[model samples]
Target: MSLLLSFGVLVLGFHHLQSIPDSWSQHYVFVKFGKEHTLECPLQGEGISWICPHNARSICSKASTRQKTLHLPNLSHKKSGLYTCTNALHQSYSTYLLIDEGQDLLNISCTSDSYTSSVLHCSMDKPFTGPSLLRVRSYSSNMTQEGKEMKIPQDENQNFLFDIQLPNSCPSEELMDPIQMSVEVMSSHEYTSRDLTFYRRDIVVPKTPENVTFTKEKIMWSNPSWTPYPSFFPLLFELTVRYRNNTIVTKRTEEQNYSAKDVQTIRVRCRDLYNPSSWSPWSPRLNVRA
Candidate 1:
């Protein structure tokens, strides 16, 4: 009888440990500066707490009886980092945060009286420790849809500043609105990933002149606003001159001009890489006469 009782006790303890439910684990997409990003951490039995980086420190103390959604504050480019959640029972779960460093909205303020070209800088400042992707969209009556995209090299700091040209080919009768620019960043870890979004308003890029002017250098096909369609001439409107993943410095070279048989309108359009829902209203239509 004594041997039988001992055997039963051992069996109960082993069963209890084996039957413990696993913790919550899933993929999460976090927006840059979004409100109250919720991360649900659920576990079996009692004692649940959210931890950042490791189990030593807890983001929330005194585990609640029910599943908890860790409310994260507005995140920035630098906020991209590793996160973990664990239960008091010694069981833990891990995930990564990817913050896309780009603009969610664009707000442009132009001087009512200034004469020289206004300087507009667009960038994403979310912190992501990986490669970055950049996409630019240009809108005009004559150009293609779904602006151009470029794979920006990865970096830990996701701040970027790019210069764009304005519309010049549109006729005076039709005034073109300022171009919109969006930036996005994503973070990666061995076990997780996260993304963030940002936006800039009223970014102005120079427009190419209508008159016939030829350049010695040949244009590349990878530009977002460039199209080689046979129906329309291979006219280029926007140019990306320089770029840096960390500093977010993008500069444009000297103005470019392309002469076609007829004149047409030119407009710049960009969409947020992370959140396409938050985009600026289309710029005023710019009309150009040949």
Candidate 2:
């Protein structure tokens, strides 16, 4: 992610501060996150001095002035906002200054895929600009469900990457939406927040079943410990059984008992219980005289 979002333009409907000329093309400066960005206040002529923005007690920030330019450093979320520059005449060239964590100042990205595996990938954008701590946590899109999160990977360089395993899909309504994650970058006086989502579709799959066992009159089975599919809860499996006569039966549970005398041939397969199910191929035919 890019640390710098936008520069040289007023954003989010913020109007310019009063006191500048109508023709001055540059009145706004936006800084990137995690590092220092400079803001220059150009004056038409001298005799007019530069005054920093302030209230009753302190200015928004203490800055270094060369002539008309102001130097600000290590910008983050809290450092962002408006700063006006006034001259001795009380007339101002109040440049609307804004600072934000760079495009991905936290220098991070996260994702999960059904084909690869069910895991969260997180990493820094690059080497460290300054010392900081990063923490990653997971939650459901809605506030109700949370706590199934992965850990942040550790690395030697300031730029680090790691993978955290995700839990198998839970069999509940809470798993319907995408999984949300918050990556917090913590420094002494500043912090950055980055959010990413793992779409539910990418972590979902009809995992292969456990050993399919057949007894004289009873059929029983279970599912694998986990599947690569995206899900917040265990998946519902729709089980199908084919009889010797080629008749078929599908059920929501994993087990079935046959009581008929002709229950000699059986083949079984399963599918995910969600809409437009992902069905598996029929199991090998099992024939026995009992």
Choose the strongest candidate by TM-score: 2
Clashes of 2: 21
Best by lDDT: 2
Q: What are the lDDT figures for the candidates, one per model?
A: 0.33, 0.46
Residue-level lDDT of model 1, residues 112-142, one tens digit each, is 1001232334454433234433344433345
Alpha carbon deviation, residue 43, candidate 2 (Å)? 35
In candidate 1, residue 134 scores what lDDT? 38
Question: Per-residue alpha-carbon lDDT of model 2 for 16-78, expressed as tens digits?
Answer: 222222221232333445566555444445544444433211333334442455555564444
Regions of candidate 1 where Cα sits further than 4 Å from its true position? 1-38, 41-52, 55-57, 60-68, 71-80, 84-130, 133-151, 154-174, 186-290
Task: Write down the worst ten-residue block by lDDT for model 1.
Answer: 9-18
